[model samples]
Target chain A: MDAYEDLQQATLHDIPRSECLQLLGVARVGRIVFADDEGPVALPVNFRMDGESVLFRVSPASEMCLRLNEAKVSFQVDRLDDFHQTGWSVLVRGTSSYVESEDLPVLRSTRPLPWARGFRPVYVRVQPTQISGRRLVDD
Target chain B: MDAYEDLQQATLHDIPRSECLQLLGVARVGRIVFADDEGPVALPVNFRMDGESVLFRVSPASEMCLRLNEAKVSFQVDRLDDFHQTGWSVLVRGTSSYVESEDLPVLRSTRPLPWARGFRPVYVRVQPTQISGRRLVDD
Candidate 1:
């Protein structure tokens, strides 16, 4: 409808799994979506990529932690360009669980630090069953 | 554990509904969480606040549209400050439905335009059943 219609056409592209993992590795934040009593909820959390898994820390008393054990969850990370209105979003669908205490030290060193300070000793990890991504860009 | 532990404490504050709506009005991007066959999928969508509901356009053939009629959805908008580790998140849980043909004209004028190019004539609206928000900030 406008002059830049040609340039504004957002061509969608499917990103390969390798590239999806690469993007997830570089991202410092993502949203974890899981089913709750009411319905579904999404909350942002600082996360780190460990091998093929996504790891994050949460307070034991936090609502997010309470709802996340062995739950089927989706972790989403996206970068948006407001100026151009082009962006890429990666969605990882997996089952989430608490990381074993024996592996806490390794995870502590490798995990991205949480920006919000609290007693976030409980570690949660999502073992991805599927990883897919799409990019919207000017053709 | 760090020197700014005092400054790093995250204070939780409840954001009033009026302020939450104001914040939603300015946001250009938000994530829409809906029930998918695999699990709950959170996809980023550009949306606008219309009265007390959230509205956005989508292609009728898109997967998002397929799952959206009278479905329970959670639309989330949040802003994060990486430097200061402070931010606010608002979650709106509601029933979603396709916009009535008779109301499309008014919605077209008031709703935020989609960034993608297409015949996105299908308009979806989420009327909130419950709206709540919280702020995470350095105390």
Candidate 2:
């Protein structure tokens, strides 16, 4: 409605897969989205990129460990600037499953460390079938 | 594994609905989780708490405008402290519908302003069927 509002206008751009992966690799925290009996749920998790998949840990007794195995899920990471009103978000759609027992040793040494206090021994990996991202910037 | 790791142990607590609503009222940004044709997706949006509902605006042509109307969705808002490893997250699960036209004038004056440049004329409101939250604090 005013000149400042015009200045606040932004353009949205599609980020390529490679760039999306790069962003994911650098970000340490993201929201993992999945459905429960009620509906969709999004919860934050500390994550690390393992090749093209996302690797994180949850408590073996947690609902995530119980419901996420082999389920279609989405992982979202973003950097938002409230002052500048600019940001980018990447979404990874994939199937989540427990990491194989054989890979635990190496992954334990190299994967993301959970920030929560309790033991998060069950490692889950989301193998993305589709990765997409978008960026919003001043026009 | 170490003394510092032991110090980093956090305790998780269930926050009551009153506290969750209080937190939601003060937060300006959140992720909306909904299912598309592919699966679950979480996208960041600037939103406001409307009574017990969540209100946000999106482009009429956007997928959110099309898929979110009359759809069951979840809106999640959180505050994370990477340094202290403490945070709280609140989730609202409910059905979304376009804000009725008659109430637009008054609602528009008090609603959350979208940061992105573009016309966001379609106002969507998610009326919560359930609200839950949790907090992680240093033990």
Candidate 3:
């Protein structure tokens, strides 16, 4: 309704797959979304990008462990700055499964050391079938 | 594995409703989880706390506009510090509906001025039917 709002164009533009993966590699945290009995649930997890998959650990009995296998899941990461009100978000839709015990040792050096304390022994990997991202910027 | 890891108990504790709402009020950004044709999606939105509900604006043709209203949705806000490896997360499960035209004026004073440009005229309000939160701390 005002001149400033009228003149400002905050355009939303798509970022390519290569760039989306780059952003995912750099982000330290992301939210994993999966279905629950009630509906959808989104929970924060420190994640690491390995090849084309995202890897994270959860408690053995956590909902993530119970529900996030062979299930359609989405993982999202973003950088939002309150001062500038500008940010980029990347969303990945994928199939997730628990990492077998045999593959666990290889991820020992992954960057995202779990921030949550306790025995988070179950490792989950999400192999994205589709990745898309968008950025909001002043034009 | 180490004494330090054993001694540093990362405790998980519940956050009360009053405090959960307080955290919701102070945080400027949160993720909304909803179901889509493919599966579930988690997208970040700059939001404001309105009494027991959260309000945000989106474009008319955006996926949020199509899938958000009259749907079971979850909104999450959190603070994570990697250095300390400690954070608090609040999750709100609720039903969202587009703000009626008659009620628009009252929400005009809310804190988050949508950063994305053009006219984001579709305003959404999510009224929480269930609110739960957890805090991770080093004890």
Candidate 4:
């Protein structure tokens, strides 16, 4: 029971994972970050949350996807408006994998696809380990 | 002058590095991506641009800040709206390094600080490699 208690305490103190998915649902475009031996890279991706995971596509020969799926990855999605001084963000850490075409249909209806060419859209999915989020509550 | 001509040709085909600053000048918040051994991560940051680099801050111990600045980094400033389905994005690939207090003046005055906080905001500069960008012109 001690380990269970500790896990509960940590999860309680941290931002809820569900909030991260909620924020992702509201945002259609956000940047994805990847870290590899070469260094850290951030790129803009049009994404939609699939269940608890994140799904997005890029052109073939994508440098970001190539690195992300090959390593433990983290994706940060945030939206902020300077004028309003209000915004929210969500970050997910996990391993990324390529989403096969056979699995696309279940995701397509809910996922907001980018305007970029889709005929060969290479999809990448990030399965989360820990998810956290923050937001500036509007007055 | 053949080398210069070749360079000029490359610039013509790609977005000029200087133009990045120009586009940044008109924007206030940008998405920042970082990675640390982990794959990729992205988040929105309230930032401004220097001549060839972009600057933003994070709180002490912030995951985004720590994971980034470890080595080669990439930050992107982009805008997308569903209605028009068109927007421009600037991706900066550079080493993420801290700007100490002594150097703040030079970095601060390069552009107005749109994002600040009571907590000591760690300043980071992203020097870019390729600054190519595209938009959905007719979408």
- Is 1 or 2 the stronger prediction by lDDT? 2
Error of 3 at B133 (Å): 1.6
| Error in Å for residue B135 of model 2 | 1.6
Assess each model's interface with DockQ, reporting 2 decimals per model: 0.54, 0.62, 0.60, 0.26
Worst 10 residues of 2 chain B by lDDT: B1-10
Report interface Cα RMSD per prediction.
2.4, 2.0, 2.1, 11.3
lDDT of 1 by residue, A1-139 (tens): 3334355468778899999999999888888999988788898888889898999888999788998999999999998777788999999999999998776546345765677766777789999999999999777
User: Candidate 1 on B1-139: residue-level lDDT in tens?
Assistant: 4344345566768899988889888887888999888889899888888888998878888998999999999999888766677799898999889998676546344665778777677779989998888888777
Q: Candidate 3 lDDT, tens digit per residue, A30-135?
A: 8899998889988888889988789888888787789987899999988877767778999999999988867654645663467767787677999899999999
What is the DockQ of the complex in model 4? 0.26
Best-first order by lDDT: 2, 1, 3, 4
RMSD of each: 2.6, 2.4, 2.3, 10.6
Candidate 4 or 2, higher lDDT: 2
Tell me the lDDT of model 3 at A72. 95
Over 4 Å off, model 2? A1-7, A105-107, B1-7, B105-107
Top candidate (DockQ)? 2
Regions of candidate 1 where Cα sits further than 4 Å from its true position: A1-7, A105-107, B1-10, B105-107
Order of the predicted models by DockQ, top scorer first = 2, 3, 1, 4
TM-score of 2: 0.91
